[model samples]
Target chain A: MANTQVDQNQVLPEYGPVTPADIRRAAWRHNLTLQWSWNYERMQALGFMWSILPILQRISRTKEELIANMQRHMNFYNTNPAVGSPIIFGAACALEEKGQGEVADSLKIALMGPFAGIGDTIQAILLRPIVAVLAASLAMEGSWAGPLIMFLFGLAWFALKFPQVTWGYKQGVNLVTTVAGGALDKVTEAATIMGLIVVGGFIPSIMARVTTPIKYVREVTVDGQLTEKVVELQPALDSILPYMIPIVIVGFAYWLLKARRQSPIKALLWLTVLAFACSYLGIL
Target chain B: MTYGIGIALLLGIIAYVAVVMNLGASCFWHEALIVGAVTGLIVGNVELGLMIGATLTLMSLGMWTYGGATIPDFMTGAILGTAFGALPGVGVEGGLAIAVPAALLMTQLDVLGRAITTLFIHGADKAVAEGNVRAVTWWHLLGQLPWGLTRFFPVFLAIWLGAEPVQNFINWMPEHIMKAMRVTGAVLPALGFALLLTMMPLKKYWPFALLGYILFAYLNVPMIGIALTAVAVGILYINLKEVRARG
Candidate 1:
C-alpha cells in the first residue's frame, strides 16, 4: 500500500498539453535550484539534458512525446549538478522535436559562457542591487513596504526566469543561434558594458591606496615655510630609490613563481618574511 | 509572539536552508532576498529586510568563488546583519555597517566548510570508482551538508540570541564609529575587485584594462559606450594591421 502511494505521488499531474506554460513551469523550478553561484556545475547538468534529447525524440512521435520529453526534462535535476544542465535540457528538448546532434551540442557549449556571464551580471549586479535599494529606500521612509519588496522581487525573478526557460524549450537550441545574430549579442554587449562601467567607476574609489613605509622629511622654517627633504639612509642610491624595492620584489617573485614554478603561497610567505625583515631594519 | 521574534525565527530558518542547500555561495541575490524577507516578515517590516539585503548584496556584488577559494561569506553577514538592521530603530545602513565585520569573521567558517566538503568529494570519487552510483549520490549529497550547516547554524544562532543585543550595540555606537563602518563597507567592494584583478592574467589584456580605467575615470564614459568603442577599435586595429602586413 505504501509502495503504491509512493508510486502514485511520483506521477506529476498532466497539464492538459505540454504547452509553453508547462516548459516555463519546468524551467522556473529548475532555475530556482540552478543557483547562480555554482553556474559551471549547473551548465554541465544542462549539457547532460541536451545530450539525452535524441533518445527521447526517437522513443515518441506525437503529443505524447511532448509529455515524455517534459518528464525526461524534469528527471535531469535529479541526475547532474554540473554547469551546462539547462543548456543541455533545452538542447535535448529541441532535438526531441528535430534531431540536430552535433550542431546543438556545439551551440550549447559555445553559448554557455556568454549566457552564464549575462545571467550572472544582470541578476547579481543590476536587478538585485536595484531591488535592494528600492526596498531600503521604502523602509527608510518608515512605510510598511519591506515585505512587499521581497514578494515583488521574488515574483520578478521568477517572471524573468520562467519565460527564458519556456522560450528555450519552445524554440529549441536554434533559439540561441537565431537570436545570437543580433538580439542576443546586443543584450550581452549591453550587460558587458554595464559590468565594465560599474567596475570602472570603482577604480579610483577603490585602488589608489597602495601604501609604503617611507616618508618625506620636512623642516619647519622660521618664515613659516616647510622644506621637504628625503631621509634616505643611503644617499648614493637615491636616484634608483622609489622604484627599487618594488621592482626587485616584483621581478624576483615573478621569476620564482613563473619560471621556477614555486607555489604562490610559498612565494607569498617568503616575500612577507623578507618584507617584514626589511621593514624592521628600516631598509625597505 | 511578536512579529519581530517570528520574523527572526523565519530568517534563521532561511539562513539554515540556504546554507544547507549551499546556495549561499552561489546566488547572493537569492540568499539575500530570502533572508531579508524572513527577517522582514518577523519584524513586521519586510521593506527593511529588502533594504538591508539589497545594501549587503551591493557590498558583496564582486564577491565570488574562484577555483573554490570563497572569500567573505556574505550569506551569513547579510542575513544576520539584515536581521539586526530590520529591528525597529536599527536602520539598514547601520545594519550594513555591523554586517561587514560579521562577514569577515564568517570567512573562516566558510573555509572550514569547503575543507570538509572536499573530503566528501574524495569519498564520492571512491564510490564512483567502485561502480556504486547510490553510494556516489549519497556521498555527494552528504558532502553538501557541512557547507550547508556551516552557512545556516551560525547566522541562525547569532541572530536568535543576539538580535536585541546587536540593536542595543548599534544604538550605543558613536557617530564616528558608524561613519567608519560605512566607509569600510564601501571600501571592501574595491578590495574584492582588487582581489579579482590580481587573479586575472592582465598582461595580454592590459590595454583593455587601461582603456576600461580611462574610459570610466577620465572620460567619464558609461560602460556601454566604452565596450562598444573598445570592440570597434579592437576589430579595426586588427583588420588595419592585417592589411598593412599583406601590403
Candidate 2:
C-alpha cells in the first residue's frame, strides 16, 4: 500500500489489525483523564490502565490476555501528563498490537523516567511559569485578559495531547531519539534563562509596597538659626538600592528554603510573624 | 455578589473536579490565577479575585506536585480567599491572612484525599483480578469523589457557614492588627519568589536575575520590557555557547 505520491513523513506506520477508530478512542481517554485517579501507591497507574483499556480490550483475544494487559499497565507509573504519558502509551499501544506485551512493559518502565524529566522541565517548570506569570501580572491589574490568556494557554496544551499521542504511535520507539536530542536541551536552557529574568523583575515590582514607614526628625543649625529637617527611611533605603528591602526579604526567604532546608510552610509562617512584629514595632 | 450561594457551590465543585481529573491539561485549573478569577466571577468581583489569584499564583510558583508529593492546596485557598476577600470589609489583605495559612493546612487534607483514593486504586486492582472491566472503570472514576470532596467541603462550608464568622472576625480586629495583615500580604510574595529561586539554578544565572532587577528597579522598565530584554540576552548567550562549542 505504499503510494509514491504520498510523503513518507506523513504516512503512519500500519498499526497491525487495530482500526483507526480504536486509537482515537484511546487517545480521547488519555487526553481526558490521565491523572484522575492519581494515588500515593501507584501514582497514575489506574488512570494509565484505564486510558489504554480500549486498546487492551481490542487487541486481546482471550479474557486472560485482557486481564494480564490490564494488570501490567496498573503497575506503578507516573510522568508529565502532557508529553510523557502520550508517548509511552503510543509506543505501548504499537507494541501491544504486535503481541509484544513484555517489550511494551519494559518500554513503559524505561521511558517514564526520562520522559518525565523532559516533559516536566518543558511543560511544568518552563512554559508554565512564563505563561502563568504573564497571566498573573495581567490578573493583578484587574484585566479580563488575565483569565482569558491563561485559559487559552491551557487549551493549547490540552489540544497538543492528541497529536502528540498520535505522533508517538506513528514513530513508536523512534520518537525517543528525536526528543532526547540537543535541540530540546537548547530550548530548555533558553526557557530557564527567560524564567529567571522574569522572576527577577517580579521581585521588585510585586513587593514594591514592603517598605519602611519610619521617619526621623533632626535639628540643624543653619546660619545661626535652628532649622528642622525630616528624613524618611524608605527614601534613604531607596537611594542605596531601589528595592533593598525586597531584595533582603527574598534573599532571606531563599536562604530559609534552600540552605536551611526548611519547608515552605515554615518559611511562609516565619515571614508572616516577622511582618507582624515589624508592623507592631513600627520597624516595617 | 453576582452569583448566589448555589451557583458558587456548583462552580467550586466543578473547579475541583476539573483540576483533579486533569480534564484539559495537567494542573490547568489548579493554578491560583484561574481559580481566583473563577471564584471572583462567582462572587461578582472578578477584579478582586484576579488580584488575590495573582498574589497566590506567585506563592504557588515552583511548588509543583512532582513525583506525587503533595504541595499546599492554594487552588482551594484561592477560592475561599477570593470569596472572603469579596466580603464587605475583608478585602485583599484579609484574604491573604486566611489564604496563606489555609493553603498550608490544606496540605494535610491533600494527603488525606490521596490516601482515601488509594483505597479506590486497591479496588481497581481487585476488579482487575476478577476480570471485571466495568468494575475497574467504576473504581477508577470513583477516586474522583475524594479529590473533589476535599475541595468542595471547604469551599462550600466557607461560602455557606464561614462568611458571617469571617466578616465578624475582620470587624473585631484592631487597627494595628489590620495594618499588620496588610504588611504581611505585601511581603508574602517575596516568599513565593524565594521558593521559586530555590527551584531555579540561581547561582549560574545570578547575573541575568540582577540584570532583570536593575532594569526594572533602576531603569523603571516594565515587566514586558524586562521579559523582552531577557529573551535577547538568552539568545545572545546561547549563540555564544554554540560558537564556543564549535571552536
Q: Pick the candidate with the highest TM-score.
A: 2
The sequence of per-residue lDDT tens digits that candidate 2 reaches over residues A225-281 is 999999899989999989899899889988997889986557767887898899999
**Candidate 2: misplaced stretches above 4 Å?**
A1-16, A173-284, B1-8, B21-24, B163-247
Worst 10 residues of 2 chain A by lDDT: A7-16
Worst 10 residues of 2 chain B by lDDT: B18-27
Instruction: Write down the lDDT of every candidate, Cα atoms only.
Output: 0.47, 0.74
Candidate 1 CAPRI-style tier: incorrect
Which CAPRI quality tier does the interface of model 2 achieve?
acceptable
True contacts kept of 2: 0.62
In angstroms, give how far residue A231 of model 1 lies from its true place.
Answer: 20
On the 0 to 100 scale, the lDDT of residue B81 in model 1 is: 68
